[model samples]
Target: MSSQPEQTMETQQQKKKKWEMPDTYVILFSVLLLAVIATYIVPSGSFDREMMDGVERVIPGTYSGVEGNATGFMDIFLALQEGMVQSAGLIFLVLFAGGAFEIVERSGAIKGGILRAVSKTRGKEFWLIATVSVLFALGGAVGAVANSVIPFVAIGVIIARALKLDAIVAVAITFGATFAGFNVGFLNPYTVGIAQSIADIPLFSGMLLRVIAFVVIVSVTILYTWIYAKRVLRDPSKSLVGVLDESQASKEDLRAPFTARHKFILSFVGLSLLFFIFATIQFKWTINHMAAFFIIIGLVSGVIAGMNYNKVAITFLEGCQKLVYGALIIGVARAILIVMENAKILDTAVNALSVPLEGLSPVFAALGMFVANGLLNFLVPSGSGQAMIAMPILTPLADMVGITRQVAVQAYQFGDGFTNSIFPTSGPLMASLAVAGVPWIKWAKWMLPLLLIWVVIAVIMLTIGVLINWGPV
Candidate 1:
């Protein structure tokens, strides 16, 4: 009879497990449902918009109460279809660009090249950490934050094991550095470009500030990583992974010697990035242009790596398969806006958000935007999706609060980019952690401090943006 207590405890544990948090899709769709419900309770309103210089600008002080067109049951599902159709261009961009990169990865050039780099810096462990961190950071800067990034994360963990560092250190170099680069977002199209386009600023208008932030964030990230490495090196217990695994580098990693093909592919990627910047700035390349360029890159990269047309086609499809979820996320998130728009409550939500910020000074107002966006990201985690939902309101709110549109965009990027490192809801981050065999609890404990420090840096950067009236360049 005494065993009855243990049986009851087991039953209780299973019950608890049943109530655990839902997946990201459930959470997003729940939000969508709630928004549908909210349309009934929240008063409808809107602001006047006019086209100026081929861009739509929301006029401030134009918000007024209007009749609510509450969404019906049928309208809910219809919103999903409309959302996908509306965001089709962006969704295809994710697929084509993703597939192109997948082809590049399949060519074996990138992995072989990075492995060779790691081999050359065998004795200087800290330099390896710094260099690899920079490489990963550069990857994020170039819009490489997807499932395919797992190979790189795995590489970082292997390097960490060889150097007697912990998994957190591995993540610090990989995810941390990538986030630093991504948050600054100098040339990252996925986040920065969408944010800029939504804000109706010239594409990549605030390049100089982004360049400065990138250098500062990446350098700080490297120093922080090196500091942690020193701790782990001096005492293995300093590792959050319990204790460091004192193992040597895997010989398998270094088997592929760097070849001329790898060199050529790397050079092509570099020049392509440079040309992308020049083209966007000088020739005004849009998403279509970027998508076409990526397809060209994939095709050329495959040919150079000696892959046949059939192999290239297969590899490209495989890559597109990887990003299918992200593309759908963009659509589902657009559904949130679609339903709100259909119900005539999107502008109402915007008015509610803008009213309070209007009372604060520009700096505090900008800071408030940063915090609000950060908090909202916990629920709406996708970057492109968040842009769709938030920017319509923020663009005009920036005008109402005497803040620059560039500052608003900066706030959105800062708020959006940093959370991906710490949040469990992020698929790429969670997958990276799984590849490295690190637990979420440990990662959160170690990463919390760096995220806080990044927040401080972000606040300073945003304040500067406000002080200088950081307008589009």
Candidate 2:
């Protein structure tokens, strides 16, 4: 009896679709294009040699600040040409991951597994949320789990609906937890790897300290999410509720049932993880190689999991194709890099901002570092790049304020990780939002309270870490 209404709703939704680009992509591309134009148009040799040298490595001579405004801007176009290959690589990764996830979901493995799993978890909401949250955090820290996590979102959403809970809450729980862990990982490949490379720290050298910090942060995130979910569920007004569009009837379509084929895929995933763990720990392989290894594993899993050979080929291609927008975003973001590097503005900006803070206490200065890093994240979306640009200056400043460089790094991380979900400039956030078919403003309103909660909790944790001298250097 209800089927007709559901069909009608689904049809209406499909017909009334809007074609808006995501805000993050829009902003990223807008900035990138504007920056490219400015880079090519601006003049170089606007500054002295030593000052310009630092900028040049980050960019090129054509875009160096030495050129007069007009010429320097024109030079930026050349830098963009130089950046094409790198930008394409980043885009390919994002797209490939997305497409792979799509194949996994469409294959009935994720859906069937989620349904079977949720049926067993019937009355254990608190524990379920906590466990899932913990897993999410772990995935974030591990990072290579992004491809895995996307499918889990669908699982989380489905489970939430079956349980009569808010789907957004589930989405938040899964993603928020994972990102919290990833961003704050004791040795996140992005931060720790890059930091170690640039700062010359021993590989996996600071394990004990990073482990302690990860435990502390992970515990807090899990606990808080469970408690917060309970409070919100009990009192609707207090909760951040996402509006469900009744017209999106496709969300309610019962997923494909698990067949023997899904079992093969699941087995492959298990074997893949075992290989990844051994490779990472035993072989001491870099995470990059490990990530690439996982991609191959996914390919094998997709095929063995009973994907029609043609479908598998198409999925890989489609996955690569979906990444074009993301690639464009990265390419555009490069424009910002070119402009800042060429104009020699980043260094000047950092120096100008930090010189006045020389007299502050280490704690306050640490806090300032956090704020500065967070602000710059809006402009520089890449965590590795931001850490590189900010840390060099921030570390020296921390030394001046009598704080350890490690503490300075924590502040940078806190700011970097927390804002990614809230920031309109974040690619993942935009991608997730687009997939969910929710408006950003609405999601923001629902998430604003949580964001505030996260900030307060993170700041409190940061204070403890700094005062107690916890965490790796």
Candidate 3:
């Protein structure tokens, strides 16, 4: 019996080591170091850029060798500073959003409301999942609700637990639904609008097909999540994150009543979200505007919750503190691109990759563009930024190969949006995962099967686009 105990202890230790999540900073820095090294091996090159219809676009055939500015060990530190400077706007937005949400969370309105909702939706849990996921998906399709969905992660967790599901299901319902809609991008201003503008196609001209894609993808996602939710609900032990679910679920205070205060707070949140969508679509609001709105919402929500000024301030700061790790990750991840840009090798990589598509058929060329954009997304995760760099090059290439510029935009859209969920560099996704308490490795493991299905769907859509000559060429 003594020997058996020792063996059990040793086995547990090995399992713990096997499942431990690697520090995100360490992983990002490792990628940064690898980028620094890549500068030496990859030939330095650049393309001439020019303003086209108020947007900067790369001029194809302007690619040429440039003098290398390889980053040394000391220069890496400078690159970090540069990266931080470049990403300051985004970093602050994330912080402010965190701060604002924290204040709202402290009010107990959200938690209380979720508990009440759980009680009400007891028998029709699948409908609850389907409804919420479809709504999120629609938001994503129209407005690109990636970061905006972060606040919902906590509520999703509550709902998932109330339904006897795991945290993974919560994340899937929130992030997964949003990303599926993002990939479809029927009218998303962030990816589709920007890519279409860059490609010089009428903005949202290909809406019919994208809308079709949206319905199919969102339906599939809801079905997939529902199946997993059913399994986990039936047997909690079957959850990949069973331990986290149990711990988190045990701590929830299900007795909190859904009072009139909760209703008002939730209404405020809902109205603010509606305003955000309108501002983004009509008035061209950026992340800065969104952050400011959140700040106002936070302060107002605090007052509505009967909190005094000092309490609100302290609670907001505490929320920001919780997200410090997630916010800093934006700057750190930016360092990889900074290092590559400072080295002048980003264009070289693009050029070399684009060279192989010259002789392929239109279908293959579109597929190649899809693959290339996906690879590039690993380095430059920003959708609009990638569009500015890629669409210009891809537009001319598409013209040369008989694929439509619209098809090229579709490829860029598919590549840029879908991978955000999987990419570590996506600050919003990482932040959501952090909020959900799901480790990146475990999330990836759970997501792989769905990801494969998504990829296949993307390929089929792109091929159809090619066959139909999706165009405004």
Model 2 residue-pair collision total: 28
Give me candidate 1's TM-score against the actual structure: 0.93
Q: Name the lDDT value of residue 383 in candidate 1.
A: 78
Off by over 4 Å in 3: 1-22, 132-215, 227-254, 360-449, 460-473
User: Candidate 3, TM-score vs. the true structure?
Assistant: 0.67
Q: Can you tell me which runs of candidate 1 are displaced by over 4 Å?
A: 1-17, 247-249
Model 2 per-residue lDDT tens digits across residues 344-439? 454444445555676675567777888878887786666655554566556545544556556667777777777777787776766666655556
Ranking by TM-score: 1, 3, 2
Q: Cα RMSD (Å) per model?
A: 2.4, 8.6, 6.7
> Against the unseen true structure, what C-alpha lDDT does each candidate score?
0.81, 0.59, 0.75
Candidate 2: list runs displaced more than 4 Å: 1-73, 86-108, 144-157, 185-222, 228-291, 308-310, 327-335, 338-346, 377-412, 423-449, 460-473
Q: Judged by TM-score relative to the true structure, which candidate is superior, 2 or 3? A: 3
lDDT, candidate 3, 165-246, per-residue tens: 7778889888888888988777665567656655766656677788888898888889988888888778778888872444
Which candidate should be chosen as best, given TM-score against the real structure?
Answer: 1
- Model 2: weakest 10-residue lDDT segment is 53-62
Q: What are the clash counts of all predictions, listed in order?
A: 0, 28, 0
